[model samples]
Target: MALFLLAFGVWSWLLWPTFLRNILGDEQSWSNGSPTAFLWVHVVIAVVSLVLGTVIGVLGWRAHRANRRS
Candidate 1:
């Protein structure tokens, strides 16, 4: 969806570099330690967006079906 694409673009611009650097540096490797800030940021964004998008999609689908039946 348009919203998802916009969100992804913004997220990539803000966090993609940090994520790549963290992984390449091995900062998140289990042997080195727990995950880094980059992973956490991505996780939070992903979870929140997924949940919100699901809700919105369901609502929109229901509305569309209702309109068609009327």
Candidate 2:
């Protein structure tokens, strides 16, 4: 479970930029309303992803330790 979460977190981080661009209209080359608005959304997502990734990585490490002790 931890390993899976870690992998997913890494994947999310890697794709985050593209996701941000898409939300910001970089992918479609068109804006929904304002670039600033979309940029904020992107920033929020990035922050969430970072937190999630960190948590998952920590979980994976802990799982490894537990396995070693068992």
Per-residue lDDT tens digits for candidate 2, residues 1-70, read: 7577667767777887677666765643346554565467667978798788778877876886787889
Distance (Å) between predicted and true CA of 14, model 2? 2.1
The digit string of per-residue lDDT tens for model 1 on 1-70 reads: 5445445555545654565455556655334567667666666765565666556656655666666789
lDDT measured at residue 51 in model 2 versus the true structure, 0 to 100? 80
C-alpha-based local distance difference test score of model 1: 0.58
lDDT of 1 at 26: 61
TM-scores for all candidates?
Answer: 0.54, 0.61
